[model samples]
Target: MRNLTTSTFSLSAFLQRTQGKKVVLIYPWSNLKTQFLSSYLDQAKDGILYYRVPGETVNLVDWIDGMLNEFRTVLGDKFGKKTSAALAERIPAHIGEALASDLGAVVKSETILYLDDLDQINFDDEFNHWAQAFVSALPEKLQLVISARMLSRHPWDHMVASGDAVVIGVETRKSAMAFTVDTDDRPQLECYAFGRGNILLNGKPVTTWEGTLPRTLAFFLIDHPLVTRDEIFHAFWPDLSVKDATNVFHVTKRKVNERVTSRIDDDKQYELTQYTSGFYVASEKLVRHYDVQEFQEAVQQALVASDDRREQLLYQRAIDLYRAPFLQTVNQPWANDRRDELRRLYAVALTGMGRIFLRKGEMNRALGFLSRAAREAPEREDVHRDVIRLYLEFGMIHEARQQYDVMEQALSSSMNLQPTKDSRALLESIKARS
Candidate 1:
């Protein structure tokens, strides 16, 4: 096994060297720690920065303009002037072009360009062209770091081969303190094993427990400390009625007893405990690491920041965190509420980003983002309205009409009412233009 401390120290040193120099760090998707880069940059007396590229569903032009405006606000008059001019020139073309021209200048001057979550950008011919141009435009003094979940198969490999790039992989290790069950004795006993793989019961390894059900359940409980027994039952038996669900609890308790009662010594208690309505997995010392948690926390923190700073933070957070719907495969009713919440939040975030793009006159990017928001939240009148407006603004008459029809259908189905007067007026205007 590699020495984690030594590896981290060496990586830190390598990162420090890239400060004030044109170096691209291509981080793997699995490594989702912004703090690592922030700490390294802080040590090297470099500032941490972020950017919000319009998503596939948003208008790129608008997103660029909004970002430039934000840059102006954050950096003050002098830096803002230079950045804004560059952004204005390149934004109309596409994010790649804009980033290349604008960020290229920063790199040329020996500034660090941290492209966090570069994996979110869809890889296509146009995107590839933009990436190539952007990388090609980088000056020797500029340090460009692109962090993503996974490596793209196309131009990314080519870029890494040609560019001065370093790849880093993050891996997880078992918790230092884990439970053990030993079934060697006539009555197996459970014990706490420190940094060992298997559980020991009565000084012997427990052979009966072969699967990971206990471990997985324990992990779930630990992560969701507030989770209730009702939620668990629902997750395990989604179709069961409330009365029938009591049977699930009884069955679960039996399983728990079978595992804990037999293993625990007469004087000791079971690791899993029931308090009030929920079960608690007693592994407080055990710490599990997940990349998704890091990503979610980063995005959530950014979103909760002040409204003045919300746009850029939310955009950056959405860009980095939204790999897919949270826990995509966990189809439990308990998760349904959270899933819906995240979906709504994501749609709002996208729409907020689209508004920024629209304000910046990047109509294409704005339309893309707004359109996606509309699709994600089809029932949301606001999202549909925004999409229709963007389509009309860009002289996409047919698209505008289509969006209006969608809105009409959605309003009729969901609310049992006609489209709002404002929406009707906008459609009328589009019709006149067509």
Candidate 2:
């Protein structure tokens, strides 16, 4: 018995559990729900006897006949036509015995009797007891998967007691929380902005931000906690006049609010609160667990560290959080400043790590890190100089000369500047060593 939720029911997890037992998948009826379940079962590897309970009222005997008709259609000769005919002809009293005998012959390897919307069939106490007995009598190889809104008074307790059933509730889905983000009923929305900007709520991506403007707006809000109307206008709609921008702002904001509200079920909605100074920020009540926030905090920690070991650890922590340039896809002028700032931090962190390793005479490791630092900031003469010095020390004179050439070209092309006197002197020294 799986108490299905929007997040918990995926094809892979469902397939994994139907190994060698009867299964029940209960859910409310909707066109979407029906399509989802049917599509999933259709794609399932094993052959399944899929039956949707009929709407008209029928006796238990007729219900059983209808179910067998579906099975006969799917299994054909394997269901044994003679036996099926015999069972259908039986009186209500002897129907259970006939079914128990016939079911054993019908069940085989990789066969599933999938009953959709079991709750649709109005089950009285006698019908419920009969269902329990009939299911128990089926071969172990035959798997039963049931879907319904509620079982109501089904004899599930007895079935479960005999180790023929298991119940999966919302809490069971919660146990697999590591794979999902809780957006429903949670106080805060977790926004991940490392590689690309993904505004996640309840472990799912929000549909509101699928549009470029809306997504960019979300990133802007998360990045700039308190943004005035003018700031938003300038950042996103620079070409528009203040009045026109204001119109766009309200429309977009409403769309964003609707998206957030639809996704999150919290009483206190995820919102952008307006300050007295006419600045807007994500609601104070809605806590944001942003990757950029963590990255910045790590860098700040590294800056204030009292010890070299502590500084190294903090810098590495910052680097790990910075998967790439902040909002790499959002090519906005406002993003450029922060992007450069983070790039600098990354380069500095790598250089500091390299220098620490170099001082300890770990030549190869030091060079590896310095090489990364140089890649992060190709025009940073200091990082390149260190790499050149390490290459010379390691007797890789050609590599040292190559490093010097790269620095010289980058400086000349980007800044129209030459390498410093120290850099020139280092190249001369590498030349003499060669």
Candidate 3:
């Protein structure tokens, strides 16, 4: 494992730190995106490139014109010469050949060429050809900064391979992280406690659990943030006396931390399970991603979203994160209770998505999602009615009747009650339509 790189949250810090590299690919991960970038760039003498032109498409020449104009504005260009270049892979060695060679010779101090939203540019090979030429030919006086939410590996694959370009905003994950990167500031650890519980350190999963108790202890700290020492004792060692449990718990916690630390390549130690203020919590210093935290946050945002499209998107994001039942493998009593709670929320999310689709006139997708909700939580009468209505709207009379029967059975088994008057009316209509 290479040494983990650290970066400050300020634009000045980032520019000063990464100025040596030719191409810096930045991801818009934070909320203060456009405004933050614009404010900082206004203070610097740099070449600007924007990929927006309302009600019209921008071609290669337009982009080049904008960039050259920016360079002139910043560097005070003395030459007005232009040269023609083909769309072939090969381009001249110097920056824009004759035009940039003049600029490079005059530049005393280094400057920046900032490209905003290069991802949004129109798909044109000729534009890409010139873009590649500009990057490859950059003199030591100027560095290229491409700020994009996403960037495809095109001509860049070679530049990155040759160490001429560097990508700043990226997380190394999966088998790909193994090859070797000189520096990275991506999340060094992440735990997805939902579905089958798993832990990853330095982009590699710690797949083996040497003991059951250690694994369960790890989940306990993650599942219930700020867990009390007493609660941990009660959950894992209720039968054992307090004196005995405390000793055992401490030993187990240390083992879990050691196992977690061993997997990471960093020489500096990190506490996977941090104890603070009479409570046990995950480490605050360690950079990490928790899927459970993301799922809950998305659901909370979707519930309050004012726009329908935004609401639908947030709910979809939350639903997609739930790959399976929470903690499916662990059968501990405490795990079971938390699992049940998360499962209920999952059903609610599914029902919410089903109704959202129904509102958009997508009856088939609505029915499919509503049916899954019914399976996970049969007691939801509203979900059943929504599914039955979609089936009836699609002229599936028999299926509607079958769904009504399932709803009736669920209510009978769970609550010993009949469907409401409004639902019964829908049932009677299903029979009449048949």
TM-score of each: 0.49, 0.56, 0.62
The lDDT of model 2 is 0.64
lDDT of 3 by residue, 100-194 (tens): 55546665666665665465556456545655766766788777777543466765667778777766532222213111222546345667787
Model-by-model lDDT, in order?
A: 0.53, 0.64, 0.65
lDDT of 3 at 326: 82
| Counted clashes in each candidate structure | 30, 4, 0
- Choose 1 or 3, whichever is better by TM-score: 3
- Candidate 2 displacement at residue 58 in angstroms: 53
Kindly provide the TM-score of model 1 when superposed on the true structure, using C-alpha atoms: 0.49
Q: What is candidate 3's CA lDDT for residue 363? A: 77
Candidate numbers, best TM-score first, in rank order: 3, 2, 1
C-alpha RMSD (angstroms) for model 3: 12.3
Could you give candidate 1's per-residue lDDT for residues 1-434 as a string of tens digits? 11222113234454554444344543342323443443344354334455545445244345445556656565544444433554556533345544555544543334555655455556666556656655666655555666654446666676556645544333232222111211122332222211122344333444443244443343345335455667776666668888787675566555654555455554645544455434443332222234433444444544443442444454556554565665554555644555676677677767777877877788888888888888777788878888888777778889989998998887888789888788888888988999
Best by TM-score: 3
Clashing pairs in 3: none
Which RMSD does model 1 reach against the true structure? 14.1
